[model samples]
Target chain A: MKIEVTSQMTGNVWKVVVAKGEQVEEDQEILILESMKMEIPVVSPDDGTIIELKVEEGDFVSEGDVIAILEED
Target chain B: MTKQVVEEQNELKQKIDKLLEKKEKYREMGGQKYIDAQHEKNKLTARERINLLLDEGSFKEMGILAHHQNLHPTMEGKFTPADGVVAGRGTIDGREVCVAAHDYTVLAGAIGKVAETKVARVREWSLKNRVPMIWLVDSAGVRVQESIGSLFAGNGRQFFDQVQMSGVVPLICALMGPGIAGTAYLPALADFVPMVKKTSYMALGGPHLVRSVVGEDVDEQTLGGSRVHTQESGVADLEVKSDEECLKVIKKYLSYFPSNNEQKPPIKEGVERAEITINERLAEIVPTNPKKIYNMYDVIKELSDDNDILAMKPKWAKNIITAFGRVGGYPVGFIANQPMHLGGALDGDAADKAARFMNICDSFNIPLVFLQDIPGFIVGSKVEKAGIIRHGAKMLHMVSEATVPKITIIIRKAYGAGYFVMNGRQFDPDYIAAWPTAEISVMGAEGASSILYHKQIRKAEDSKAAWSEYADQFRNLIDVEVAASNMLIDDVIDPRETKLQIFDAVASAWNKKVERPWKKNSIRPV
Candidate 1:
């Protein structure tokens, strides 16, 4: 299954934790967002390989923006 | 004895034998072929479900011989055994409960007038006896063939009766199969609704009706499947993989709830003794750094007895978690903010979820435990247009109106209105506590600094440096000790001692009582 991890809040990408094609476990931080003066991590929804990292570090993403795509195990 | 007396006794015996044979035939349930088909679909027969749910040899079947009374020429030879419903009183875990299992093998489990009467009778028994009402819904809605005319207006008394039963008794509805149109409402008004993964669905209109009425083509699963309801719509509570698991989940759910609102939840006395032990994992589970994320379930596990937390609407509103678990063997509803999603912030959906769960807990006399790591409700124009104010108000209303014992734990950030809705000190939490890492403030220090010292920073030679300096000072002042000194909270405790502190408080408030000035009811926020 393919899952799109979307941003729950509008924020700047503090850092990209995983690269494209990297294997990540469920809840593994794929990226971090700086929002509301808090560093919120966007975690993988399931154990999967990250097919795409849509945002880069320092990029501003709005709420509902796709952060990454995962191909689930 | 005379030959005439012997013949008369033989005749009575034959009549009794015939009645038993008729019941045996109805038990076949649309014969072997349909039963096999149901099994192939990974579903259980109505009788099988009832058998699995109730105690051994405890089912007292009712209306087993019931059949439809529709006299239309098209239905002249139709045979609908039990009128497509298997209903009776049975005991589950030694407690009596009324069950109505829709038999999908018969007439596709289309509900007819007779079957409705049978279900209504069971519902009456449930209400009159103050026992829990369980509905194994697998119906294809009303029998449209029999009521193809204008008499549908007089029907729908079931939902009205359900509303009356709500809050008074635990009304549990499990969707084991398709629940189309009117049947979908069974779970809507229910206190607990669990749907079978692939086999069950609930929609206001089935595919056929939907296509013709609105001219949109869609399948039943896509429209109202377990995923759609449990994840997207928040209509169902839990989605189980199979029929057996669904029934087991129901039994487990009932264990946490009293049969009726007049009683307190059942306790596992053995588990109570082990609840107060301080688990070192609790300290490791939560991060002292507010920005660093941690799973709230980890924290919940350390507090719950046996680490068993039956979460409700877990997939939807992922920001908030509404779950039933035991602390000190006493059933409690834990409403915690999930930092993994939305930085543990409360939004419209999160507030709605918490509000509804609060009503359920408060109504059933279950003590509530608030795990506050909230950054407060979501702000900005997008949420305002989504009616966040009114939706957020529901939580405030429920938290204030909830008369049950409330225990608040400010683990990290308890800022803004989130504190109030999450049972802040003003909300009358019986024993409110904060941890050493707790930051109880009106707002985040950074945001408050920017607003409060906007002029000071503007006048400073280096505005950015001045702002940071001011923000650092404000951040230090937002500590738990300030609240402690002001006596705003009960006490600040070590993170490792959370389980013991909560358990002792819950045990003490077991016999809590609250009296309110009587009114019909307060008009709560929608």
Candidate 2:
């Protein structure tokens, strides 16, 4: 079972640092979102593999949107 | 030219003669000791700190000469100014504030007979002025010499004023001395406290006093250091290396929220930093292998507002990362988990730290950001016996009751109780987004596979191999589009588009904002 990485606050998907199938540790910055002149990095929960990316660059989001999923280690 | 030079010298000599007379007058009053004490007293003056925090030339002096001179009418020339505490009014960042800085050189900054009155005056002035109060505490304790007649005096409840005003008005304490005895409680009473290391300490009593009473040798540093209060106890909000650093941190903390809940915060010019393409890099950030721990800081730095991110209690809460940062130009609260520490599990200290922070943010109406990377609450006999359940529940209550705009970005694990506490679907977060590389499941693939297919795997030709094979099947690689295609989560977002979506959601929440319609809710639930 893996955990999905989502945006904590709403913003634009400014950049996606992790690629699908790449490995990630807990608290590692997985994705970056720009909102209200701030950049928020979405991070991973466990030592896991990135399985998918949901939102694309320039897409607007609200709170609780899934940005990526991490298959647990 | 020679004649003009001679005239200038004469004027300069006259000026020097006047200075000598004034110095001699001060010397005659109580000899060099009095002069030395007075000059030394000025070194701990709040003038410098006040200037750094407030706009220049904004501080207006109040009760500067309001000392105990009235009681000793016969000794008219024996009056002291402000009784070693400089209490005054000032505009800190255009917001009105009343500040009182203790003069440490004056009898070790002991509270005098009338010192409490001066502070009370400042506190009352702040309440009347409808402004925040800043107390620069560097005192040893009460003045034992003048403690005789204080009972009859009317200033016994000065400290109580601070306590009463805690939730009523914002109180910030900057501890700049070896915080001992009573000074320790003052900071604890305030909403926020920023302390300087080595120079600052907070203790109910010095270790020597405690040791004397208990017959144990307790060292001072071990008893009341910045590390103990900020890291272990969570008494102080911020621990800075120097006095200057402490002042700067105080300014930054006050910048985010409004002066009070009744008002909206002033939107300052937004931060300007080099914008990097952080969203586009998310695809390669989270690893495909479930076991490898990727760098969450990279995503945090990318998603953070330029240089607005300031992580707090970093050493204590290794699992949950709590920070103070800004969105646009307004201050907001940021909480995330780091899988690197205890697999991003919530512990007792981390929960307490985040809970208190959540209370403050929610009370002040600051929006919350949850970086959900939590496996679950820490289990095991040690954690349970240590009261992890009660402490973890505190964090849950704070998050759920927080009425401010909340957004949850689940970057990785959100299993069990950690899911709900992190503002999952149950909390009804304003916006919920997930990345394409998400596996929304409980526990983990390894545990799930063992529980579900243990008997079947044992029957296989190779039991151990079958277990591993079954675990792999539960992995995201085995089924990529299962959760998203089913629409279990609201939407799956690309890493690059995450920022834009968060902004939109916050905007939507802002637009849909409806404050508590009742009489501002009577009680403050802890």
Candidate 3:
């Protein structure tokens, strides 16, 4: 199953913690967003391997933007 | 003569024996086997639960002999005792309460036509007598055999009555067993729902139905157990270890509410101020830095009498704290913004939570106390798409319509529309007080300054230093002193005198009859 990880808030992408094809556990941080002077991490919703990274560091992503895709086992 | 008299007495004895046999059947409650099964599950029988809930020997059962009258072949021969429910009037700690406990032993506690009527009748009684109602729901939905025509048509009355009794009398429900399909509405309508752990489960559709429709293989526990409802869904208010514990929790909860909307909450004697004293640490509680988060609950505890607070919907919309507490031994509702969560912003969920709570407090005539530290309602496309405007309007409508005495204490930041909806002077709050730490403004200084001086700051030799200077200048313009000087707030009070000020305000407004303009009713934003 392919799971789309969406940004919950609108913010500038501060850092990308995981790379494409990397194995990630559920609730592991995929990327961090900077908004309202706060760092909010976008975490994986399920245990999966990162198949695609949609946003780069410093890219401004709006809420509901798909930041990455994870292929679940 | 002696022989005739003896024969007559013997005949009377035979009539008494038949009456005892009927009473024995009533006590059986679906026979001994089912009763044993309930015990094995570590659950109290319906009657036993009622006995535990009410004061000793205070229950007066209303419909003990009620039974199903359906003549269908399948139901005709069945002996559905008490119509699978035991409803009655009872006293919990000398306070009168009506209860309807479903008997799981009887036909799996299915709601028959007669049982539905019995439940509705007790609800009406509760409404008329102005007594709180308790529903011990453990039904396996409606009786399938009797789910036809008028029987199905009349089912809506139960839920309708629940809505009618919503703010009038406290409606509490305990989920002791499966509450699926139609039965689930009981808990949903209740002011408070306490579900027993492990055994209690509720769902609109059961596992079998899910499997058939969605091809999901799930067990009943995994689908709608106490853990899921209490922790994830926010449907159940509390989870207890057993049926007895659930009853105890309900008793404690009802003690904080009045019997009906027309009456004031019963006051507990000897409830003194907190022993630790609030005055000393009150000044230091709110940090000087605007970005730092402090616990709003700690402030509430300091202001409340004896640190007593009964929080509602604690898990959902955590940014806004809604609770029932006392000041100077008088009941009042506390609506505060928790800076610790989401910077105390009024999001859609927080707005909905506060609005509903305000309506309840207003209906019951409980005074309102707002401790404002709200930054503002959340902005951006995300919240807007989530219908923040409609949801946020609910708070405005509720605050405007609330007839109860309102006192707003601005402890920290009160920016933008958050100030207006949090019972600002425009809302005609009875009293408005502010602490020295309060910063009342249209928006936070940083955001306002950045927007207003964007060009100048960007062109400055040092952009960060330029932005900070502009922000400080903006912040100085809207401090607590400015607000007080402009007469926007009633007074800038000392942090230590907060509880006394709130108490005096509520006490003074207690008997003042304020006339409201005549209106049928205003429409609330949906």
Candidate 4:
């Protein structure tokens, strides 16, 4: 199953912690969003491998915008 | 010895035998076949559930022999045991409460006309006696056979009676099986609703009704299961795995509440430590950095008595947490901000959750403890369209109106209106304290600097550097000591002593009283 990880808040991507084809556990931070003067981590919802990386460091993403795609393990 | 004396004695014995026979038959509850089927689905019978919830041998049943009076042509020669409802007064943990459990073995636990009367009578008994009411609903809605025609006009007094009983005493509704249509409203007006994972569901319309009326073929679980209500719809409070767990949770939930609004919450005695002790783990669980995230549950568990907390609506509105726990053996409701989700920003749903929890705590006389680490309400076009203002106002109104003893601990960022809604100094919190890392300000330095120093930064040759310099200066001004020195907040304390501090604050304000001019009621925000 493929799952699209989306940004929960409209903010600038402060950092990308995972790379394409990288395996990640559930709740592992995929990227950090800086909004409202706080760091909000967008995490993987399930244990999966990143099949697509859609955003890079310093990129702005709106709330509900898909930031990464994961292939379930 | 006259012959008349022997004849009278024989007649009395015969009457007693007939009464015992009737009681035995009604107690069987729709026969053994239906009872076995209920067990196959991992659900307990109505009597079994009531037994588990109340104390041993404490239940005093009130309408066990009630039979339906419905005379519709479809109901000819039909027999209903207790009118499909088992209702009466009982004691949970030795405290009085009234309960109504739907006997699903009888007519699938449909609410017949007489069953409705039985439930209404119990509800009235709860109110008149000022005792808490619990409803174990597992019905297939109203009995259509008995209520299919124009006779339905006289129905629906239970909901109206529930509205009148609201806030006067605690109401708990547990969905142990399907609660379709009329059965769903029982939980809708309840204070606490727990749903059994696989066996329980509540929907205004069942799957069959949806298929026929809307032409959408949805299953029972998909339509309104534990996950749907507890996670998505925010209708139910907690989801338990089985009927046994559901009954156990109800007992735990009631421990934090009083029998009625007029009485003080029953304080547990013989706590290993009545006095609060300084726990060093609190400092380790929270990060001092403003941007870093930590689980609020870790801090809550360390502060709560015996690490016991009943989290309400735990899965819904992940940004804000509402839970019931005891501090130094005193029951209190904790409203904390979860920094891990959405930067701990309050959204419409989060606001609604917090506000409703606050109302419950206030109504039940349970003190409230707020742990603030909020940034502010989520801003922008998206939230605006979602009516964040109305939702935010509802929280603001609730905090202002809540007369219960309120204790606040500013764990970290307490910026903007977030501080106000989280029982800040302005909301008349009984005791408001901040940690060394707390920043009480109108807004964060980064956002404020961008707007206040916009012209200065734009005019400078090095705008980026100028902006950073200005923002740093603003950040330096946002200090916890400034508020403490000015006496804006009560005190600045060490993070390690938070539990002891909160316990002291709650104990000191145990007799708090606030006076206000009487009115019908203030118009609260939606």
Candidate 5:
């Protein structure tokens, strides 16, 4: 199953923790966003392999923006 | 003299025999052929379903001999046993409940003139007696041939009765077969509807009517099947595989409610399988990092009695959690935020869901426990267009109007208007406590600081670094201790002590009563 990881808040992507094709566990932090001067981690909702990374470091994304796509194991 | 007496006894015997024969016919239920067909369709007869729903031998039927009064030549000989409905008062798990099951065997369970009257009568009885009403809806809509003029026009009383009984008593429905047109409204008004998979269907019109009116071709299942109602439309609360399972679900749902709103929910003896202890894990379960997400369910479970909680609408509007669980073996309703979803923001749907749950709990006199981890109500033009203002106001209205003892524990992130809606100090919750991790703020520190020091931060050589430093300083200002010092909250306590604190608060307010200014009721925002 393919899952879309969406940002819950508008923020600047501070770091991209996983690259495409990298396996990640549920609740694993896939990226950190700097919003309101706080570092907010966007975690994977399920254990999956990252099929696509939609955002890069320093990218500004709005709420509900898809940041990554994961293919569940 | 003896001969005359014997003759009178013989006459009485004959009359008694006739009455017994009539009852046998009523029990026959559309004869063996129709019953066999019902079995073939994997559906139970109406009485059989009621038998499974209620305690055995407890159903005292009301209108057993009622039949269609339509005396037209075509309908003259038609045998409408029990008027195609079996309604009565029964005990489920030894608690009184009123039930009406539409019998599919007789005229395909059509809601004829008499059947509608029978249902309406039972609804009235249930409402007056203040007992929960369980409707086993499986009707083929109004009997079109017999329902004309007065019969068709007077059919609306049933729906009216349903609306009247809305908050007065719990209404539960199980769709065991097709319920089209007029019959569809019963389940729609029900507080909980469990649809039987495959056999159960509900729609405003059947395939034939739809085809005739809209020129659309569709099958019954395709139009209003169990899957469609439960998943696509969310009209039904659950989809069970069989009639038996549907009844079981109804029984379980009723366990959470009292027989009526006037009484407390039935207590489960020795329900606390585990001793109430402060789990140290709760202290660390909430992350110190403000922006990190944590599973709120874990914290709820740790505090709930025996770690047992029944979450309602778990999939819908999941940012806020609404559930029924026991705290210290006393039934309490829980409203919490799931930071895992939407960063625990209150969106339109979340507000509606929580507000409705609060209303239910308040109406039933269930104590409410608010676990605050909300950031704020979602902001944006999209949400405004979605009517978040009115919906969010509904939540506030319910919380403020609720008469039941309310205990609030701010685990984390009580920010902006979310704080007030979640039973903050302004709402006058009976007891309000906050964990050390709670951040009582107007907004997140970063956003607030940027607005306050906009010019200064913009003028800094490294504006980003300057903004972060200012945000950190503002964040430290609104910690739980600061709020407690200002008397904005009751106290800042350890997370592990939450269970005990809430239990004590609820116990102290167990007999607390409020006297409101005499009025019909306050009109809540939609």
Candidate 6:
């Protein structure tokens, strides 16, 4: 299964820490999203590889909208 | 008929002689000076306290000089008069109220057999009159000399009266002296308790008793000082240094509410206390560096009306500040966390203090100004053991339940759940403003870079140097340019102009109408 990490709150994506198809582990943080000027982490829930990053650099995401998806090996 | 009148006059003279002889006998036994001194030291003489609180000469003393005398031969000499409590009825600044003032010097104003009856009478009067009740408690709890008999007399009637009167009419109790043991609980059930520092002490038992009961040793101040009560455990509402200040707080607090909940709020002058001016140069007051810290107190002080900030528990909750300050002469509750203390983190004590203050202000229809500059709650295994999760969540729940007008100002840092707890947009703040220097992120740049971008920097030849380079890039995410792209915060206002903007925002929300039950004096959770 892919690592589908979505935003928990709505705000601008302040920073991207990982690139597409990057290897990730369970509980590994993938990116930092800023909403209401607060940075929230988009992390991997399971050990996987990022297949597709839905939001590009500096894109805004809503609550529960996917920010990135990871493909499990 | 003239002979009959002469006979009556002779009988009166005989009675007067008997009273004079009794008075002389008491004087011989040293009762005269002791009774006279006690009568002199009463909070105010019956006439004066009544006049100051009630209409001049309006109070009708229900049971003046009501006393208890012994019918049994062994108890012949033991008689108590009003048991040192003065309870009566009169108007307080035009509003009628039932009042009870304890006479401190009289047996240290201890509750005795006759005094408990007087307390019951005034409590009953408060219930029957439907007027507000103001108690001036300056007692040393129950009389040790009277002991079990007095406790048995006072056991049930007084509490039943307080319970029946709660929320129906505002019962204001002022602890003006050494309030030990059972006497402390009077204020515990009161709608408000205004205490005088050093003079007042409220505890279930005195230090000696506490030491004996709990196997701990401490003095009275260490046990029940005003500082301990107001700041540590979150008990006392307002603490004044003297008795005069206590009376003033009582008057001011009463001004906010009606005599009873049935009436409407008194129309204020809406007097603008001079326009709070800001220097044009204040726009650049916030520095660009994320690491550079500014004194939030200076900013808050400059934004408030000149000499108008009334800080509460100031010395205790240093990091999380709370005050009742006037902006343009309109009162507002201000809550700001000072980053200088523990990096502006919310500890269990601060969270509990702020949450309690918020609930009280919101219940009274006061507007709130939450100054946000927080890193997060203090995190560690130690904090976990202190039940920080439960206490922190309690604050979050209070923020959600608050129905008052809320304005959030992001002065510097807003990270993690601290943002949500600090009147963030998720709680539907009426307006959210930020200083351009604020870095609103999940975590600080160094922490984020260390945890998330570790590999990218580790691959570089100089890992330490590469880590520093990545931190700067992460800091760039929290600049004014990024904030402008997101509409989360309403506006980035000048640091000096914050007061004027917040006043305008709150004034615009004035005349907000919300109705509830007729008797809605919120009884706090036990």
- lDDT digits (tens) for residues B1-526 of candidate 6: 6999999999999999997776445222224565466445443333334456655778776655555443545435754455567778877666778888776645566776667777788788777777778888877787655554544553656666787787567778887766788788788777677777766778889887888899888776667767567656556766776666776666666654455544433434555635557645344544565434445566666666665566656655566888776667666778888754455778887887788778656755667899888988877777799888888886788887777778898888888788888888788788888876676888877778888788988798998988988888888786744664688778887777777788888887655555545654444332
The C-alpha TM-scores of every prediction are 0.95, 0.74, 0.85, 0.92, 0.84, 0.71
Q: Report the lDDT tens digits of candidate 5 across residue range B13-120.
A: 999999889987897777789999999999999989989999999999988888999876768789999999999999999988999998999999987878777887
> Which is superior by TM-score, 1 or 3?
1
**Candidate 4: which stretches are off by over 4 Å?**
A1-7, A10-62, A65-73, B272-275
Runs off by more than 4 Å, candidate 3 = A1-73, B1-13, B149-151, B231-233, B271-278, B458-465
Can you write out model 1's per-residue Cα lDDT over B1-526, one digit (the tens) per residue?
8999999999999999999999999888888899999999999999999999999999998999998998888778888988899999988889989999999999899999999999999999999999999999998889987776887877899999999999999999999999999899889999999999879999999999899999999988889998789877999999898999999999998888888999998887776555377688988888766667888988998889888899999878989999999987889999999988898988898998999999999999999999999988988888999999999999999999999989999999899999999999999999999989898999988788999999999999999999999999999888798888899998999898998888888889889999989999899999
Off by over 4 Å in 1: A1-4, A13-32, A43-59, A68-73, B272-275
Clashes of each: 0, 128, 0, 0, 1, 5
Q: List lDDT for all candidates, in order.
A: 0.91, 0.70, 0.86, 0.91, 0.85, 0.70
Report the lDDT tens digits of candidate 4 across residue range B208-243. 999999999988988998878987799999989899
Better of 1 and 6 by lDDT: 1
**TM-score of chain A, model number 1:** 0.96
Identify the leading candidate in terms of TM-score: 1
**Which residue runs of candidate 6 sit more than 4 Å off their true CA positions?**
A1-73, B1-63, B68-79, B89-99, B113-133, B144-172, B189-194, B211-217, B237-239, B256-267, B270-297, B454-463, B480-485, B513-526
lDDT of 2 by residue, B1-526 (tens): 6999999999999999997776444223223464466455333344456667777898786655445544444434543445667678877677778888876645566777677777888899877666778888877777655654655364447677776676556778988776678778888888778777667777887877888888767666567767667656778776777777877877777777677766655555754323333466766777765555555666666675664577666645666777777655546678887765555668787788788778777767777888776777877787798888888888888877788788877777777788787888678688877776655567667778999998998789988889888888877442324655776556777767666666666656763465555665544333
Comparison by lDDT, 3 against 5, better one: 3
lDDT of 3 at B257: 82
lDDT of 4 by residue, A1-73 (tens): 6778888878999999999999999779899998766788888866789999999999999888999999977
Clashing pairs in 3: none
